[model samples]
Target: MKKEDEAKSRRSFLKKAGLGGLSLASFTGASAHIGDQIAYASQNVNRNSSPSDLKITDLRIAEIGGDVVFRTPIVRIYTNQGIVGHGDVRDGAAKEYALFLKSRLLGENPCNVERLFGIIKQFGHHGRQGGGVSGVEMALWDLAGKAYNVPVYQMLGGKYRDKVRVYCDTTVSKDPVEYANRMQARVDQGYTALKMDIGINLIKDIPGALINGHEADYNPYQHQSTKYNMTKHPFTRIQITEKGVDKLMEYLDVMRSKIGYDIPMGTDHWGHIGVNEAIKLARASERYNLAYMEDVIPWQYTDQWREITESSTTPTQTGEDIYRLEGGFEELIKTRAVDIVHPDPNTAGGILETKRIGDFASKHGIGFMHHHAAGPVSFLGCVHSAAATENFMWLEHHAVDKKDWENLVTGFDGPIVKDGYVTVPEKPGIGVELNEEVVKKYLVKGEKLFAPTPEWDKIRAWDRLWS
Candidate 1:
């Protein structure tokens, strides 16, 4: 009877072990994520774990004023360690993305960028969705960099340069004289490189007869009308005829004469026209010798970009919408489509990703330029990445006109930019913080923009899967 009882007890214990109760091959075959099961938990003891260990805290939106309004939703990641990572969602993107990603990131190590990005990317589509991912990634990297005691660029295989050149935007006035005066003002501020607006649509209503029935028309409501006309690319129907192209050339002539030949002038905001028209416009700008034709064609047309680059002496450039250097920039680099690769780190997956894009472009004998127009967080991020990137030509500073824009970020000792270049910060990570007072002054409706999330407080179906 004693021997029979001992055998029965052993059988019961083995049965209770479940997968451990099986043969080695059977156990391995039967278990999903066997390694994780074996590692995260020990059969020796049972400790209660809940998804709240990964609860999301909060999401807040802040608006900063500039030449253009930039409303950024900054995401804060709160961990058990009391360390928080700051992230910025792309301006004009839905705040929900930053919020949605917060759930996916709960309980995971923000330092594990590769894994987190993989999971978050499943929910991210193109365009604004891309911005949310990029912004969240920026914050994660910022947190990782702080935790690791390194600048974001150092994580990107190390720094390649110390100072990043900035490009100043010069707005065009309806009056050519006023436009010329604005161009001179940029030079007065010690800007060596300047980008000006030249939208033919702005002047479409002017009386000019085209031999090809190409007289420009105006309609503010209709996208095809004058106000909307400047929005087309070079390849589309609203393109300039030979005569119209001459008129544009005359404007460029006046601009070049004012800024002079020595200053490197760039062009942008040419509207959503198609690629063929883009080529014509680019070719026309050759007479004035522009540094590059920025966003001349729609960003998706890589073939057209290449054609324009090949046809015009001016380099073709695009990137503000691109999320990663590898996905969008790699294709352009392979084809030598653009003379320069411009990336907005906020939209281009933050510091490391932008640097990688720049490095890739450099390998192809192309220049790398950092695109701006986001908030202080993004601009600071750009400063760090551009400082470390080589083959960097110039970064954009669209809000230079805003006296309060630089003040939005704190902990930096002095003006970030002196002369025409932005100096790298010796401090850690992005090297700047938000001025609570300034943020409050500029925020819309006193929004509670950056609150801590309690990852341990929430339970969800999705959260249970990873744990």
Candidate 2:
């Protein structure tokens, strides 16, 4: 074709594809490279740069004031290409836990998620010890999603639901009627699922409700005694008497009658009681058709969990404090020890691992519920994972009463929680940015917001645990 004809063809193509604004002056000098430049520009339109070249540049921390129970720390992973990702360290965990991983992540491509996760996975442990590595893992997924111009759930494969069902963890009141009234208020606010604390602590003052307390001077609610918090389930030797059981039953009966059977109800915080007592409480509360009895005993006691699962009509659940899927939750799911596997993503090795736990559970006919108590960063991580995983039953919304909880982050198209469900965000990454103005208001006293973490930028020792 003639040179004028070639120019005319190019113009027609650009205009047809809505690239008419792109000047053809640059192509005049180098006709051979015109097609290449156009293709590159098309590829780079939505992205800052080539996704493969994006590198982790820095990691920073911010501690925001949480509810009375905790001060939550948020993590931000910065990349060379200007895409930043957000994550939340487990509530009450140190910022140093996540900062220490900065050395491991610096100059590495965030898109190689599994490779980066494998390199840092050794640093994580069960419970709060896993906060640092898990936080870093979450930031990686967010960065990867943004780099590719897709939502995190799409990067995980695809979504199973657009809105993840959320259950509020309602505070328990000592008075049964008051507790029922409080739960009724949550239902009035459009929550379809709820969980409340059910334990000996509520009736500890009543005569004949508890026995063997004088031996150790154990206080159920107060953790002043080392014997109460440190002792394991079987070793505690704590028992609830028939009168105590009756009081708990009465509380459940009142709650059930108030909420009715249409909404599912779950319970937790059993005050570190033992397997036998867990069974007794489970059997007594079975008539109400509770959603699931959570952490009745510690998650490590798989056999005890099996006993509770087989003996009671109530559903048994555990694993919020557990870590990793292969070793942590595999036994529980494979053995059918629990009806539901509840993983708090901040403690469960972040989003991908949590989804793996849920996928594994689905194979065994078990349910999945994510336990969440941090700020919006980790909550959205759970939202993305819940959207990707098939077995998800619900994600915990612990801040339902905290009117300002959703304000900590921006970029949400609508209300954070609508009618007891969080819409799975479609924007890149976790689909939100830190609302710096709101976050500044909630910074913990004496703590800085996204402060420099230079001290953790170097590694002094080899980290290999095996030859």
lDDT of 1 by residue, 1-467 (tens): 36576455444445645645544543443334445445433565523223234333343345444343476666666665555566677777766676666656666877777677777665544456677787777777766666666777787666667776788886667776678789889889888888888766555656551221234344333544454344444424554567767776777788877778999888887655667677778877888888888887767778878887888787788888787865677898888878888888777776777888988988889888888776777777887778777777888987777778777778877787777887776665677777778776766554665544444234354633353
Please, what's the RMSD in Å of model 2?
Answer: 3.8
lDDT of each: 0.69, 0.87
Cα error of candidate 2 at position 14, Å: 4.3
Model 2 pairs whose backbones collide:
none
lDDT tens per residue, model 2, 1-467: 58797777666556745755556554555556467647945874774657989999999998887452257888999989888998999987888888878899999999999999999888888888888888888999999988988999999999999899999967789999999999999999899999998887787788788876523345443644555667776766779999989999888899988989999999988777788888989898889899999988889999989999999899999998888997799999999999999999999999999999999999999999999888888899999999999889999998877888888888998889999989899999889988898888888998888988888899977998889
Top-TM-score candidate index: 2
Worst 10 residues of 2 by lDDT: 214-223
Candidate 1 similarity to native, TM-score: 0.78
* Candidate number achieving the greatest lDDT relative to the actual structure: 2
